[model samples]
Target: MTSSIPSAVTVPSNNVVPSTSTTTEPSTSAEPVAVAVEDSSNLDNDLLDILGIDPTTDKKYGKDLHKDLSVRLQHWTTVGLDKDLKKELKDRYLTPGNCKLIDPPILNAEMKAAISDINVKRDKAIEAKQKVLTSAIVCLGEAITLLLPSKDKDTNLIKLLMDAIRIICECQHSD
Candidate 1:
């Protein structure tokens, strides 16, 4: 009788690849396992630094910065020179009543007074600038009106043209 058995094939040791599978079992060793934990404090600091924010500063400093930025953005938006640009600025900088910093220092009386004085000056300057701009616009409109056709011949057309110009001037000043 002849017995049949398959011979085992052995790969060369250097050519053999380790199995990719893994098995999990309760650890038998008495030693404690070392766990890797992320330091959240460092992460917070990193985020603050990335955003150009200094959380350790006094509250007053942040408030002052916010106030100044608000004024500048408000002026730019009010000028209405570029609608898209103003919209972008408003979205980025004008979060109403939400400009608090992490830990801002309290402002001293002297500092508060200085800021108040500066704001007063800024308001006056803005008013003067607006007056000048309005004067220029009116002067230009008057010059253009002088060049238009006489109202006696083209009364209806002249009225329409004048109305359109007035609307434009009103729109510009209202902004």
Candidate 2:
């Protein structure tokens, strides 16, 4: 029984060749599982599957997966796994959103102001346009003219438009 027991050292199997590996399990304790190195591209699909994200939709696949996964992993306090593998996973998959590398401002007041200003300007323009549309009433493709800055009825673009409108209106009425 003692002779049957293999040592902790990995001995070559019966058909041993120089480059070929035929390592036997460590007989003393639980055999250390030999995990194969997976191709990163394949693992990316697996990670996306785990995250319930569609691969096809993420056109820039690697960057997209890294960004999304890193965000999700922030709240994950505990993960039980091998130390080296955990480090490797963190280093490889959760890279782009690495909080350590780029300290991003969390949507501060300046950003808010810029965004709000654009929205306000857009709204103002839209409101102005709506007023033009509502008040003008398109009277046979004619918008009612507004007064110019100098109140120049003789040489104003608005008066010219109004004149064009009057001519068009007259033609429409005559027809």
Question: lDDT for each of the candidates?
Answer: 0.47, 0.43
Q: TM-scores across all candidates?
A: 0.23, 0.16
Q: Using TM-score as the measure, which candidate wins?
A: 1
* Cα lDDT tens digits for candidate 1, 1-175: 1112232233333332332224233333443322233344657766867867556664563234477888887876677447575345434432223322211234466765778777756656654444434443444455455657555566565565567557645644553
Q: Check candidate 1 and list the clashing pairs.
A: 58-104, 58-105, 59-104, 59-105
Using lDDT, give the best candidate's number: 1
Any runs in candidate 2 off by more than 4 Å, and if so which?
1-144, 148-154
Candidate 1 lowest-lDDT run of ten: 1-10
Regions more than 4 Å wrong, model 1 = 1-115, 148-175
- Please give the distance, in angstroms, between residue 116's alpha carbon in candidate 1 and its true position after superposition: 2.7
Report the C-alpha lDDT of model 2 over 41-159, residue by residue, as the tens digit: 66766686786865677775333447777765654435544667545543443312322222111345675577877775665665443333322224312233234434545555665
